[model samples]
Target: MAKELEGKVAVVTGAASGIGLASTGALLAAGARVVLVDRDDAALAAICSERGDAAIPLVIDLLDPKACATLAPRVLEMAGQIDILHANAGSYVGGDLVDADTAAIDRMLNLNVNVVMKNVHDVLPHMIGRQTGDIIVTSSLAAHFPTPWEPVYASSKWAINCFVQTVRRQVFKHGIRVGSVSPGPVISALLADWPEEKLREAKESGSLIEASEVAEVMMFMLTRQRGMTIRDVVMMPTNFDL
Candidate 1:
């Protein structure tokens, strides 16, 4: 049986771990050749080795704006063309805003917000020329609600939500689909900032969800019919409150 994404190419950032890794797996299973981009060279190599030719690894730190701006061209060089882009690279800054380190805030915003924007911007010309593409960003449930504990992280996602919607409108005429997936309290490295007790409490309460679940939602967004755009998907554990 033929898969839905056969012959298409996808570029996934932060592909060595967490949601990016899970999403890469999903895209590969659906028959898309995936370019795995991450700073972790060893992990990327391991994934490529396991997944074979379909997994192309690219090591680049998105924190450097210059490197980020070059991503689409590099992927095009490696893959010939990009049919999909999952801008999933991001960092987390939790806790009260006043207690957050200014430097840490800067880094998180750069990765979560700036990198996403730059990557999509770089890929637009290509997708526009082709008149077809799918761009899905990994946002957070916090983007839709005011989460007091992680104001900085939530704020970054809120910005992404707006960006995705605005960019979707601008590019729909070109046959490019843009959207975001917002998952709450996903089980990933981003949770490292949470207090041990809070993490345990969420887990015990069934308030945490796996990264694979979020990837599932991403696949749904990517696989939608061209006529309809799933602009945003907010997924959370059924037991999660607010």
Candidate 2:
């Protein structure tokens, strides 16, 4: 039986762990060859090895604007063409904005906001030429509402929410579909510092989801029929509050 994404080529950033890793696995299972991009070379190599030939590992620090510019072309040169660009690379700093470390804030914005824009800018032209592509961003529920404890993180997602909508409009005529999956709390490294008590409460309350669950939603967004576009999917645990 042929898979839905058979013969497709995808580039997934932040692919070494968590949702990114899970999404890559989903894409591969659907028969797409994937270029897995991450900052950790060793981990990326290990996973790519485990996944075999379908996964191509690229170690990159998304914070470098120049790298973003060159990434798509590099992937194209290697993979021939890219059918999907999963801009899933992002960071989070959880704390009151005033009390947050300025350095952490800068890092989060640089990766979560700036890198996403740069990657999109670089990949859009190729998709335009092909006149078909799918760009899925990993956003967060915080984009929809204020997150007092992580103002900067929320603001970054809010920015990308607008970006996805605006870019979807810009390239829709050319057969490019742009959208985001905004998940609430998920079991990932992003929550590693979430005050143990809070994490415990969320988990115990069934308010946290697994990374693989979000990965499946990403697949749904990608596998939609050509005429259909899934703009945004906000996935939160059923018992989640707010």
Q: How far is candidate 1 from the true structure (C-alpha RMSD, Å)?
A: 1.0
Q: Report the poorest 10 consecutive residues by lDDT, candidate 2.
A: 61-70
**What digit string (tens of lDDT, one per residue) describes model 1 on residues 1-242?**
14889999999999999999999999999999999999999999998999999999999999987777779888999999999999999999998888899999999999999999999999999999999999999999999999989999999999999999899999999999998999989999999999899999999999998999998889888887788888888999989966
How many clashes in each candidate?
Answer: 0, 0
TM-score, candidate number 2: 0.98
- Model 2: residue 138 alpha-carbon error in angstroms: 0.4
What candidate 2 gets wrong by more than 4 Å, as runs, is none
lDDT of 2 at 114: 90
lDDT computed for candidate 1: 0.93
Which clashing pairs does model 1 show? none
